[model samples]
Target: MILANVTLSGCTGANSALCAGAGEGHLGGGSYRTSLTPTGNLIVAVCLGFIGTFGLTNNLLVLMLFCRYKMLRSPINLLLINISISDLLVCVLGTPFSFAASTQGRWLIGERGCMWYGFANSLFGIVSLISLAVLSYERYSTMMAPTEADSSNYYKVYLGIALSWVYSLVWTLPPLFGWSHYGPEGPGTTCSVDWTTRTANNISYIICLFVFCLVVPFLVIVFCYGKLLCAIRQVREINASVSRKREQHVLLMVMVMVICYLFCWLPYGIMALLATFGPPELVTPEASIIPSVLAKTSTVINPVIYVFMNKQFYSCFHALMCCETPRRGSSLKSSSKAIRAVTGPRRSNDFLFMVASLGQPAATVPQLGPSFEPTIDITKGPSSDINNPVVVSLVAHYDG
Candidate 1:
């Protein structure tokens, strides 16, 4: 069986059946250059460069916003920070490498490097996917049971962040264990799971990956969002128009998220499945690229949906870029007061008495008694009589 290394220039030659001709090529590691047409190389490179740059810049901005502002320091924002980190890793580790490889029109990273690229790319992608699901659940928690969500027990969020990486490692590491392996796939220009291999182990690996990474996460997002919508509908006392508007707004956001997610991933998932399980010649290298680029473009789309959509986030980002204080910072406002209107007087506030009459002379009113009656002096009669009890105030009650 011939292991193929084909030139993309549409040529055939003696050195390689896939090579079209022999010529001096761009100086790579060695002098060997064959006829691989750089037909769409520049376009692919430009697009990839745009994606990498756009994703890197925006994701970094998101990370910075989350880190620099204390007001953003909530459980939901913490989850967002995890997401930003994952996407930044993708931009740093995967996107640039992929862009470079696409520019060269070949897999310049070679065999072992191919494995690393595939593994790291898959790892970050999985992490981002899981993070999105977690973000949705976090939103649902905040919207559905805000009091519980607000309470200080951040261990769950931290544990979730930790587990995302661990779960990614669980799937991506099996390649090293030889159950499934990474190698150059479509066009020999890129590397990924060796889909052409039809062994039981390879098939099993793909099945598990699809199930865990794609199916499970998809279901989690769906369930969380469904519950969120239901909770929104069940909310009482809100005006019908206001509730519908809220429901629609949330629905739009959810739809955008889900649609973009499927837009980026569905094609690739379908293509990968077809390439792995179908006839050997059914899917071609060039055809496989559509999904790859689409999937990587996800790094560009996520920040838009997650950050730019939020007006406050946009304001914070704008403030941050201008080297000014964050106008919409996360820090607690100093103007807030912990005012508890207790019925009984404490020594700290003993001097702050509620005087109800002007006829009262220089005298200290008696302290609160049973029923929280604040002893008042209505008239300047005998001090003892006046102190007996002038008037009692009614306690106020609030109801939702």
Candidate 2:
């Protein structure tokens, strides 16, 4: 990803005559020299630095929020936790190398370093994609079947995470095994997969890898989230009391992350595809530069999008930052007060009215006793007269 412009001054051993007319001549009038100009290096550096700092800070905040807040430890949050971890990896490992490559316009790390860098980069990228895909599927299942999906299923999420890491390893291992080559680019070398060879075999392998690893996974993410949104709409229509606002917020965040992911990687995928099948001359430094910058950008943006956009995450983050422990007793007391307010004596009839309005077939008008007792048939359906004032008195007294 490094681009360097070199201007030779006074050639060394062979071409002394070329420097004769020049104002500043070399020792033998044949000295070899070069002038390196940084193109977009500062911009790349600033972007990498900003993204790295933000990603690390935000992701760590997310992790701490999940760890510190017991109430936030839901199955859905577990998926987010995985996403944060993957994002942190990208920020820590990928961004630094990107900054160096863009600024230096050369791969100072050498061949082995480049291989390891590529492996780590590919690994984290795969983890991010798979984690997002898994998150989408989790949302789909939760929206489609909430009662069927409980806290116990979170262990399956853990298993899926383990599987994702395994899958990522499968993709990253090939380069190290010599099945593929990854190293610094030409004369003014930079670290990247050595795709500039323009060989049919190399091109085909890259095209296949891009399609399977990046493109297909993105499509899966979109499809899964689309279904989840539809299911959410259906659920909200059926049960307006369910309050899907928080889930919708989460879905929007995931969608944004997915869209950003695609935008960042799409260029890289396209470049790789083009590099494989096209002429070598077409693989210009300028052509690859933007894609490199964009791909690096994706690594750093994930944490920011997740935290700032999510309210529950923000609240938990604030609680953690303030070093405030959750007060369970106070929360329980508040819950009790809320329940009483909803189901209290004066509201008994209101509750019954709501239940009856739900169109349950077994509703009936109950016979009131002299004591004004509200008899609720838990087995059958709500009683029509359950909303009577006397019944309300009975319900309040019974609850008290």
Candidate 3:
């Protein structure tokens, strides 16, 4: 949680009077030495405004798309729809208040308001993290263990989604229960975990939060994506061209999770840990606020990645928004047609691949023609009708 007021005061002779008592603001006697100028406040406002607006709009569109299209209902995409809900919560519950405060240059919401804001922020943020970890694991299992990936077991993800909310709520609610506390973090305009407090309870909560929420989730995401990549490589080793799309998709998944966690949450985690255990001066208000700002970027970045990277979602998005299918010559249309052809009318194979691909038939493959079999013998080489069938490139598409 972060909060601020009068940060728009520039160091001019006129503003000097306005800023005089501002620099002397206190959180437990530690002075607010952050040079929160009008420029900084404006920057914060603009960034928050853009992220808040665009993130909310896009995520809502995502949710609506999922709801509007019956075909979009799948276990994997259900995870994304859940994520859209979480992001929407963040936008509605957290962004407006922060944006108002940042623009107005003050924390108008009282102590109670601060707690609510912090609670919402932590709740939604943590849910997003856990949801993503679950998604990665789900994708991994669907790809590598096709047997258990059927719709019969897809109900498991919904149960996991409910538990994810509880998991986030469990950790975040301790503050309300007197195990820890919440308050304005940096500027006194936003609210969050009381990192400045050095106490047995607060420290314990912080450590446990870091371990369970950040560290554990981070490790899980890395492991799941890494394993998925290795699985695709195994496919490649058997049939080179058949695995390119799979490898790239898995690689991109790994990069998104790994990079987002490291950049968005790692700094905040480090600074929070330092606040508890390192030299007090090292975790300055200004320094700490940097990471906090970075973390908020994840809300905007996540949905964009999903829409741009996944062919299936983008198609649905395009169709929903534009009121028409992708143009016939468009790469997406070609990809869609190609994928449908590869898995064409082959219920058994498509069903198996559907589970493997997380219930989204989004992959594009080199058209293997009418002779294509639902059950190709992995033991046999390419047939004459499919002279270059072994050379046929396959894209492991994801519907999510």
Residue-level error in angstroms, candidate 1, position 254: 0.3
Model 2 lDDT per residue over 139-219, tens place: 555433312244545687887788778878877777676555665432222345666555565556576678778877788
lDDT of 3 by residue, 176-210 (tens): 88977877666544568887567798888988999
Q: Please, what is the whole-model Cα lDDT of each candidate in the order they appear?
A: 0.62, 0.54, 0.64
Models ranked on lDDT: 3, 1, 2
Clashing pairs in 1: 9-37, 11-20, 12-20, 71-330, 71-331
TM-score of 3: 0.74
Query: TM-scores across all candidates?
Result: 0.73, 0.67, 0.74
Candidate number that wins on lDDT, 1 or 3 = 3
| Best model per TM-score | 3
Candidate 2, superposed: residue stretches over 4 Å from native: 1-36, 185-190, 235-255, 321-400
Candidate 2 lDDT for residue 163: 71
- Model 1 spans with C-alpha error above 4 angstroms: 1-36, 236-238, 321-400
